[model samples]
Target: MALHSASVNSKLIFAPAGKESHGQAEQFTRGILTRSDLDQTSPIWQFHKWFAAAQRSELVAHPETCCLSTASLPSGRVSSRMVYLKELDAEGFVIYSNFGTSKKAQDLSTNPWASLTFWWEELERQIRVEGRASRLTREESQKYFDTRVRGSRIGAWSSRQSQVLKPIQGDAGDEEDDGRRVLDGWVKETEKRFEGEENIPVPDFWGGLRIIPESVEFWQGRQSRLHDRFIYEKKAPTEESVQEWTLERLSP
Candidate 1:
């Protein structure tokens, strides 16, 4: 079911926690979410708190990963992919990737809107973000690129992400092996070309995108299929410096 449907049925629907002979499900009573514990002044702070908690726990290996969804403007059919959330601020969530390369990036080009989901199964918590995707400044992109390892930085050049690869030419042991050799050649060449330079050239198409959230929702699983759902929606843009936001609990 959609999170914000006009039907006014905000209750969450989930199959019981298990696949049983009688289709019975396990109840999730692991955690409690209260408005008193969540800060209304800033949803970002609340998000940081939850994210920090997840990071500190041994249960999470990579808490920064989030699923990002985007659609082609004309078609409206959406596609989702896992991306690492590299940065977060009052502005919103940030992720870096090759622009105009992957299908998701193409979708974002046509339709700037995006939705992000961060689910920590161990914590039974999820955060959903709806926003517009906009490119980061060149300086911002370069700054992050500087922090990447040598091989990954070179990979940005060697890989034309989501692009179809050409069939390897000439006689070879096997097709897959030939393709691997071809890729390795590119990587080797890239490494050699940048060996002398202190700063390798960041791919012109590689950069970051910030999801400027229109709304952010936090969910916590509860017992008897009741989940805590709270959403913070931006009040709207104005001439003022600080944007206002409204927080409310959805019936779940």
Candidate 2:
């Protein structure tokens, strides 16, 4: 274990962290995991294995970060962005975003279906999740919102995220610097606006979305350009029983 520290609002926060690389790339052999090795009941459990491995591997940074892709219905316009996976359970995957600002949010509003991808390049593994996205309850959103860093919480309130930004006028020479100056000004203003205010409420337009998976596929790299692939697909719910899922191996 190793010790690490971070400063937030002039307060020091310390924690332990460590992940060491084992050997040279050339020395590491290709990974192999067939369907027999996969969890047959719940892909969520299978995800736990890969996720834990990624977290332990030195090459994996931000293992919880995944690509969330949403498509606008009929038009088929698709957009994707990296979002931190905040929660994962028997329910689904959870992430927070500005509900009204981002195109991805808008897309999900129109079409609930979404696709998520988690790629651990160093481990030669990728997991794809296809599911329907739904807004989390107000209480759930608030609970998680309270855990975010102060600046992030303020950001959810300030600077309309994903909105078209106005270009600065006049000769600032360096537009990038001028843009940052304006943003910093907004941050300061927001901080003051919330001064002495405890428990900054979650923004009405910002909250969490949970993806309810219907199908999930896991891929592992192997030799000779062949790969190991397995999928767990949710079966249709019967009137007498709840939702059930089945696992099957897929052609590489």
- TM per prediction: 0.86, 0.82
Tell me the tens digit of each residue's lDDT in model 1 across 156-202: 88887887666566566644543566677789998888887769766
By summed lDDT, which 10 consecutive residues of candidate 2 come out lowest?
19-28
- In TM-score terms, which candidate is top? 1
Q: Which candidate achieves the best lDDT against the true structure?
A: 1
Model 1 has an lDDT value of: 0.86
Deviation (Å) of 220 in candidate 2? 0.1
When summed lDDT is taken over every stretch of 10 residues in candidate 1, the lowest stretch is: 13-22
Error of 2 at 147 (Å): 1.3
How many pairs in model 1 have backbone atoms within 3 A of each other, for residues 3 or more apart or on separate chains, i.e. clashes? Answer: 2
lDDT of 2 by residue, 1-252 (tens): 335554445444233222424332232145888778887778888898889889988789888889999999889998999999999988898999998878987797789999889988788889999999999988999999999888899998886777655546646675544455566667888899999887999988999999999999998877655778889999988798777788887887
Off by over 4 Å in 1: 1-23, 169-178, 237-239
